[model samples]
Target: MGNEQSKEKEKHVFSTHELVFNQLNEAPVYCFDQNVSSEGLAFSHSNLKVRFPSRQDQFQVAYLNAYLQLGHVDQTLSVRARLEDSVGSIAVIGFGESNTRSHSDLYLFDVTQRKVYLCGDEVPNVRLPVCGDGDIIQFQVDIGRGRLSYQIINSASSKQESATAGDRSLVTFKFDSADLPHSVRPLFGMRSTSVTEPSFHVLEVSRELSLTDKALFDKESIYGPVTLSNDCLNISRQDIKSNCCALIDKVLREGTHRWKIRILKDVGASTCLGIAKHPFYVPNMYGMSSQHMYLHSQLMVWRSYGGSLYSSGSKLSHELRPLDYDDKPVTVEFLLDLTAGTLEIIREGVSLGIAFKGIKPPVQPVVVFYAGCEKEVQLVSFHSNAPSGNNDDPILLKQSGSKRSSDRVTKKHKKRISYAFDRSMTYGSLLISPDGMTVERRQSHIGNAYCLINQTCSTGVYNWSFKINEDQGASICLGITTEPVEVTNDAIYESKSMYLYRSYMGKLYYNGRELRKEFEEFWMPGTIVELILDLVNGVLQILVNGINQGVCFGNLEAKAYRPIVCFYAAMPKSITLLKFEHFPSEPKAMFVPNNLNQGMPFQSNGLSEDIEKGIQRTDRCMVCSAIDGNVVILPCKHAVYCAAHAVVGEYCIVCERRIESIVNVF
Candidate 1:
């Protein structure tokens, strides 16, 4: 138990302090300084003022020093000090350039012995232009290996230059007096030929390393093996000084274990690589090259849920046996090429899946490598095929089901009728009974000879109204009639009765007055006359009673057209039949008759009496002027009729016929 506890404790490891530096001071410490003139340059030592005195005085001047690892410093480097006067005078004292005549000479001194080594050295110098009254000069020193160089710049010109020794080597500088001018101040700077050491620390307790930190460190440095051990773990450094050979033997014997490895690189520094361990079911037996190596084990695996294996690949040619034929272990080998965006599966030296031509492979392979019941497995090796140059394509995974359906229906509706006439008629009377039945009438003759009520009339009636004789030119009377009228000429002419005669020779008359003279045939056979009964902006136009004759133009009066209910006819020489046809009913297109004078007059079948009751029931009696009293019912209950009314059954809305019966209602 104690050993186990110790082992657990040993899981953490610490590193030695490879290098150390003094706090130096929150305020910057004077490192080095130099003075320069046109004749030569000189180096000087710094005097550090201490806040608290030790054994001597509160102020002390010590040689500034730094400790570095072995081989850290090389030739061409040395340590030195520099000083500048208030008037822009400058000097340098150090381990190099101490000749008074040489422009590269420096003041030399030995601080431990308190002896002056070299003084008033003149080296190649650069003088800066003077500045304001109290302008201070600036100086800097470069140290490395066993050599040093010093320089200074004035406030005015602010230019700088370096000096060298006669032997082209380093020299030490010292001063006999320790006193400095009241107006002169020492300024220092340092430069080295050695590479700069990183200021980062590995063992900062405040900053604990996480998995991501470990991964990033492993990705950056090549000297350290990010380690986990019973005794010590160092992120960037490992020391095996005590048991180096023993540790090496142990590592060699145990080899590497197969585990997931995550390597993170600085986004601006390097590329990243990730590798995961294979399970026991998938065998990982692929060989490795120098650039690429297996992660750990020699086999990969994918465990099966029901001991059933499904094969997947770009194209499957044959079934592959498990790596462990006895089902003891199941695994498969797959190759991933980041640059080409491809993944290939190899089984038994045969290529089973090559999914590289397109995008990246899915998160996991379509087929599991080792699939039986194993919980853990191993991977032998892994390496990059290339630098992942630019695999622009993304991985695609297959789905299992179909997509959803849209919502709108897409069909059409059927049509009903065909060609239809769209025009208007003139001088024609349209009759609409109370029950929605409609009829049209036109007068074809004078003296009530021919009345085309609904497409039916006698020939003599049509002739007396429409045809006039050339010789003697019989006079004609015109009267408009919507109902069938009895034709009688020169026989039993009663008062207020319509008649046509030739008494005026060439004039037609209705009541002994000439209706039309020299008769241009106002009512001629096949003549179509249209009367504008009413017009309202040409929209609500009534050609006769219930007929809407659409829009019209031209003068109706000049055309011998009048709104009065009248007809046209000539004296008897020949009579032509006038026919009238009613427009079709509801949902049917309206028809405008062409020749009003040629329409046949309407005739009742003498069954008007029987149908009258049915017409009255439908309430389509139009001849009577009764507002509402005892109403007569039709057989169809659609029309009504009364006595003393000319019951035109053909024009009756009820029963869709003319009202022909006189029925008394209780």
Candidate 2:
């Protein structure tokens, strides 16, 4: 039985070796190595293994039955080795079957780095009482993606008191094939004191590395060419031309370029001049400057130097003066070269003078008339120079002359505007005339006293109603009526006062108390009361039946408020307010305390002499009045017109031709 058992163990060990070798062959070339030996058996390119001591006393072994060594035939890479097993197997190995042994662990090795990653030296041995089986164990290793992994697992429970004995069922390990040495070997196996053998199956699979795939991928490999179409090119051209001039100016001002200028043409002429300047320094000389000027025509060149003083001013100060000289219009050309610090200007096939020496190369050349005295000017033509290499091809101006007709301009300024206040007209109706004058000649009306009652009640409950006049005054009449007494009561109450109150801007106004209260339900028969509200100038003027009562002055600050006049009626009859009037006072000038004539117009000494002589003979002339030599004028335009004979349209006042519009000048 012993010999039979030994033969069976040998067969199991040989099968394990075959399984490992076959597994290695099936996997990628970097899976295992064939140059590691243990005891009498050599573990070359193989899977992981675990072993135990044999019970046979005669056979004292130096190595265990289960062991493994792996290598990569195709690459020099590091491989991790480990063990794995089922959960039941782990429980059996962790806790002994009868609490005889402790737990089990795993061992790891990196063949490429040639170092032991983890040394699972001590493992517990255990046995399962129910199954009556000892712990089972195995190992695994994987190599891929420049990394390695390894693990170990015990499948059974074995109650073994030995320190290095446990039921380890399974193990796993992995590594990167790229980390392995191309012709290297792996060393891994078990050690024991007796001849014992364990069994294991090998696994091998190919793993594609994400890193390698990423390194080899290319986006352009899938898509083709990227080029703009003709339409796109045209669009780009339009955009460039529209913004290019301004962009060029900005670049020349802020960029390394030293100077820039815009030359506009004089009216009705085609010739233009553009000048630019650049500054440089010489080692031995003072700083020097260069000016590049463009003359759109030979006529312009002649006119510029001809000493004709058509316009006075230096080129820097004068604006673009019109050139009325007879000459063919010429387009301008521009050229700039930073390397040589030179700008070439050509117009109508003519080259302007090269300005190589100047005080500060004209950043912007002072424009001068083409044929007039060389005075500074501002306007220059856009066609002063065409872009280089493009001949005569007029760079169409992006912004043409205004399209609005001259007639329209004249018509817009000639119309008369008006404002109407009729209800048929829309609210806020303001019509502008072509002449730009505003005419507001219409008036809004406030009807009967009953209307006043409605207006007042609505104002108290809702919003107040008032007529706003353009002359800076408003009429507010409250809608309220008074009740009248009978004939018998009228005798005893000769006068009965009924008060009508209205509020404006935090203040209240009592228009008047009327004696007649006859028209309480309809239009009140009492006198109509109205107030001229001048909130702007802060004054309230009261009026009873269109008669001015008095004016009150105070601070009346409200967003929307007007002076309101109320009336009370003692008889039942319609009290009609003929018209709502708002007469705002005009501003007057006062003397400057010490000087009476400070704001008055000056008069000649001759006039003063004549006036003095005339004043002596005019005590009855009725056309002169002088107090402290300051004269007063009447409506007849008569200066110092006496009170008695200040006749209208009969005398001259300050040389006034018969008074058409009587204007009082103070």
Candidate 3:
């Protein structure tokens, strides 16, 4: 029982930590997107919310990255985000690491495709949960071990798969970082473009190493029947300390490899570990005379080992060494500098002061050999740097030569988008509904038409309203598309998604690029037009006052689209969004580790059945969790309620004062 308890205590536990984001105390630890001004943006190392007044220029991007250079990368790094934005605006939040956009190292979590991407390319036939409206996304990058993972951290939606769940990750991706060490600039950015000044706040950057990252010897990687997880190496049947042999497990390359080998069982005469450029004991392995380069071989002499020259069909004269070492494992480091063509041997973290120059290109077949056929010579940790490089480390990430962290993180309250009619998705008489769940346009006679935002629903059936209150000279085109267009003439303009317009001349558009056909569907007062768009099967149809208009557009390439309503200054036009199934719901990516020192868990994915039922029954404000849940914060478009409780202290309470305006829903 005591042994069992000890074994249980030795097992490594998994826990998350708080992230170090762009902080306020020090200089901005990251570089912001230059295309967008950082004026009204509120950012910290743990949280960030970007917003501003309606100026002439807003950052015309769906999402921007705050590129941070973590000078030296570790085994694993984690980042969490709580995305709050409109539909189709941000498909997914991307974590990229490269010098530039083109021909660079990029990792993207494609929300629409439900696939993770490396370098803008797809990750084959893998499918993961897509971030839905008001969802938290956790992003993790394990560079040394080569892993990237994400998890949806909210419990409100059908796709909520937070760390509190059994999986601990939504979707984990793998990539090779060994080849691209130079491309190590990780950036936090977004997908698509956001016309509105979207606000993002809850975030963190943290790291931790798993148990497998220890520097102890790996028995399986080494050849021969070795002991179970032991550092000692037995070269023969018995432990005779002379002429016994072994090789290091790490495979080093000529130019890009460095290793540190310790002399464990070094015998005085024949037990020594040294550099060799060919397979040990292989006859003519390199097809060269002296195993490609000079080493202590049976045919070569040992006295003159430094200073190079001379080649021939005849055997080349060479040298070797009775290497200097003691019974205590004397550490020796081998550095092969390919550019300068020199091999320097370092002893116990100190340079041995001996360098072999004139070592030119194509430095292949790198190996370290030990000769002790009768004796025993062991190689220990040639692939490591320090003598005992981080042994049995606890649950914490080793930072860059500084503060070690062991604090536990419990996520507090993270804001969820109050899904409703977006005020920013309107103009003139067109705007968000009073209830904040639909888009509405009041009656007007000017030749002005309001268009739904190009970003809304990228995939799935999109159902929208096309009502006509008092249609006087109304030229309204109601269809599903992702184009930002308004009808000035009696026709709909070409675009990327799809559209249908009804004026004196009714015209149907395919992909904003093709104008298919024309019909004479004139607008009438009290006419209820319902546009049903099936984006998945590539079919679009319309219902005129509960009457079906067959299939207007078919076989379309897959893409998310918003409902568009164009008005050419038509008078008396009042249209309200009756309802939307899954159309107008935005897709946000948010992630936050549980911070005990803060408030409640941010996404709260692991609530009890009763708690979940209570949450479902609750209709309170997102910030205060009170009952006034009915208002939309402007510029950001996140709805809220609780009038007196609305304004919390100096910060906007909900969005942390990242907005400039707040309007009642009703």
Q: Give the top-scoring candidate (TM-score).
A: 3
lDDT score, residue 406, model 1?
Answer: 8
Q: On residues 472-501, what C-alpha lDDT tens digit does candidate 3 reach at each position?
A: 555566676554533344334444444655
Candidate that would win on lDDT: 3
* Candidate 3 wrong stretches, greater than 4 Å: 1-47, 51-74, 156-169, 179-181, 185-195, 209-397, 400-666
Candidate 1 residues lying further than 4 Å off, grouped into runs, are 1-150, 155-337, 342-666
Sliding window of 10 residues with minimal summed lDDT for model 3: 589-598
Work out the TM-score per prediction: 0.15, 0.16, 0.29
lDDT of 2 by residue, 256-297 (tens): 122222222232222233332211000000010111112111
How much lDDT does each candidate structure score?
Answer: 0.23, 0.24, 0.42
Candidate 2, residue 262: how far the Cα is off, in Å: 54
lDDT of 1 by residue, 89-119 (tens): 1112233221133322333332212223222
TM-score of 3: 0.29
Q: What is the lDDT of residue 43 in candidate 2?
A: 31
